[model samples]
Target: MAKLLMDLTPLSYSPALRRIWLGGIFSTVGYSITGVAISLEIYALTSSAAAVGAVGLVALVPLVLGGLYGGVIADTYDRRKVALAATLSMWVLTALMAAHSWLNIHSVWVLYALIAAESLFQPINQAARGAIIPRLVKPRLLPAANTLMMSVGTLGMSLGPILGGVLVATLGYQLTYSINVLAMTVGIWALYRLPAMKPEGTAEQPRRGGLSSIAEGLRFVRGNQVVGMSFLVDLLGMFFAQARPIIPALAALSFGGGEIGAGFLLAAGPIGALTGIAFSGFLKDLSRQGRFLTLSYAGWGLGFTAFGLIAWVFDGQGQGASVRESLLRLSLAGLALAFMGWADALGGVYRSTIIQTAAPDHIRGRMQGLFIITVVGGPQLGTAGVGFAAEAMGAPLTAVMGGALVIITIALATVRVPALWRYVPEPVPDTRQIPSV
Candidate 1:
């Protein structure tokens, strides 16, 4: 019975992790809300899916640079300091975003610049924290630890949009952006309490990271099939079928709810993900993570395929949708997204665990940086590509086409890399070494 639920052991075991996990809930919500708000804001401002999709294009270069450079920064210096500085910077930028609306100085170019800058710092923070976690918790509890983190992130995904939708609908963009500024303090405080997280072996061979360091990291990934495939598979999933850019259009033209409908569509995947992670105790000791990850890819493809078909069939202009009819249409789409999120939960956890566990600690930060790129940056790029796609082909056909590609790509990859499902993590014993300030 207990194994059927999320393992609470990680929360119980580590004080530092516990504090961050708790605070992260709020900050993650803040981040999640702001993402949706930006999309809606762009769509409202320009009414162009291309403009909305451009958000991803603006963010892509920064994300790639950040992933490459951020990994080096995390590996070379004190990770805690890096995460702290980046978090504070992110807070300030988000505050500026609030000002852009409140001060009535609205420009998509300015928004693009701000988002691009924010994208840079975000990955630096992610790389630092991703590398630091293995130091905070016992090595054995790594899977559980990641599950807990995923829970918080997924929770933010679930709640942020609903709240963002309601607030954006009722309050307008000015106030909607301010909430993130306040919510992030909790996470900043969490980082403040964390121990100094220096990567292992830094004392004896401490050095700065450069292009050479990045190349070395890339080499490692190229050689490690499991970790390499994890990144590849995730990129394919997000790049082909990521549905965010077209969501507003889907709401207005297909699903019929406007801002509220858009919000429901945005939040659906996270809600599904949260439900899966909340009850993920059964996955605690499962060794067949690779097998399940492959299965997850299949399910992810199917969910998006299903979602696209529903939108195509029930295409409705936003004007005349009865409240009940709108609700029904949105529910169907959301349900499919939920199923995708459920399937993604399995893949997300397994892939993350595999990456964190399989990589040597020395290069863990670098690997995690790449992981963050795939998980976050890939979606950003996809949003841009598919945003334009939605504009050209309409949301329904674009989604259907993208989902089909995902299914095909993974099937071929699996056949080529037969050992992906055969991989298992190399264990490290518990070492309670939390570096202090």
Candidate 2:
């Protein structure tokens, strides 16, 4: 048991990583606080589930653009600087959001704009941070390191929103946003302490930046079948399996428990993810990453399908269902979400490990940037898609149908992309060697 626990040596191995991880936890907590606040505020203002879903649509384009260009910038300049700049931008935006709420700015459009601004910088911040991990830890410990990051992140995701819900309910939006501002400062401090992270070897020159750099990154992904397939699988899973945006509506209209219930629903998956990561010492030795990834997605689909079924059977538009029955249904729904979260976190550990281990350091930033886009953008797109579908067919039906689609798509991808199934991390070649462009 001690030996298994010690697999997470990366946390103790690198002070830089430790600082980054701690800072990320604080930042994520703040983000979660603001995230719940904004969603609830938007829902309250518009009284429309579609309006809450539109938040995802508002931020998606800027996030995509930031991710692509942010990769180019990270490749061309000091990544630490780029990341710090982006983090600072987010910090400032959080303060602005707080101010907006504190002063009673009632325009939903202003809220949307603030969210968009934050989204623009988020990918840049994430891309640099993602690329920095491989440099911080040894190659042999990459999986453990990834698991540790996921575990901490899952911890934040689990606790933050629950805390957010309570804080927002009692303290209101202004104070919740202010709390986020303070939390963000921890991330900024961590970035400030990091060593400079200039690109390895010949960095891309400013003149060879922008579209040229993006094209090079795309070319690399295109040529790597395993990496390409990993991204594809993740994209499909997120696109179909994301059902978070409807939690508020589900809580109020289906479960009869309102905001607190929504928070529990939101927190359920991360709770499961945290639990999975606690036992993830075995993952470091796993070689059949492709198979594990496929199984994880399948698990996510199954769990989501179960959640939908529970809602369909027990919830009747929050009408006539007794309080006891509603609570029971909510508990079952949370259990299903927890199962899905565990599966998703398992898949994330492998996906990140494969990407960090396989991609060479020279273009790792660009690849990580693309990875950030897929991670961030896919869910937003999913939210928009699922939200629209829910508007048409209701959240319960949407989840069932969407989860089914994820299972079918992943199955097809596995059968079609045999290379992905057979993928194993190759030994890291000389760091000085760059792939031919």
Q: Which candidate gets the maximum TM-score versus the true structure?
A: 1
Evaluate model 2: give its lDDT: 0.83
Off by over 4 Å in 1: 206-209, 426-437
Which regions in candidate 2 have their CA more than 4 angstroms from the true location?
Answer: 2-6, 203-207, 317-326, 427-437
For each candidate, what is the lDDT? 0.86, 0.83
Write model 2 residue lDDT over 1-437, tens digit each, in one string. 65444266888989999998899889888888788889888888987777888888999999999999998887777899999999999999999999999899867999999999999999999888888888888777777878888876798889887987788778888998999899999999999999999887643544475898899989989998888988988888888877677887787777755666777788888999988888887777777887788788888888888888877775566654444656876788889999999999988998887777666776788888899889889988888888878888888898898899989998898899877788765554445332321
Q: Estimate each model's TM-score.
A: 0.96, 0.94
Q: Where does candidate 2 clash, by residue pair?
A: none
Total clashing pairs in model 1:
0
Error of 2 at 145 (Å): 1.3
Rate residue 322 of model 1 by lDDT. 46
Error in Å for residue 58 of model 2 = 1.2
lDDT of 1 by residue, 222-264 (tens): 8878778888888888888888888888888888877888888
Q: Model 2, poorest ten-residue lDDT window?
A: 428-437
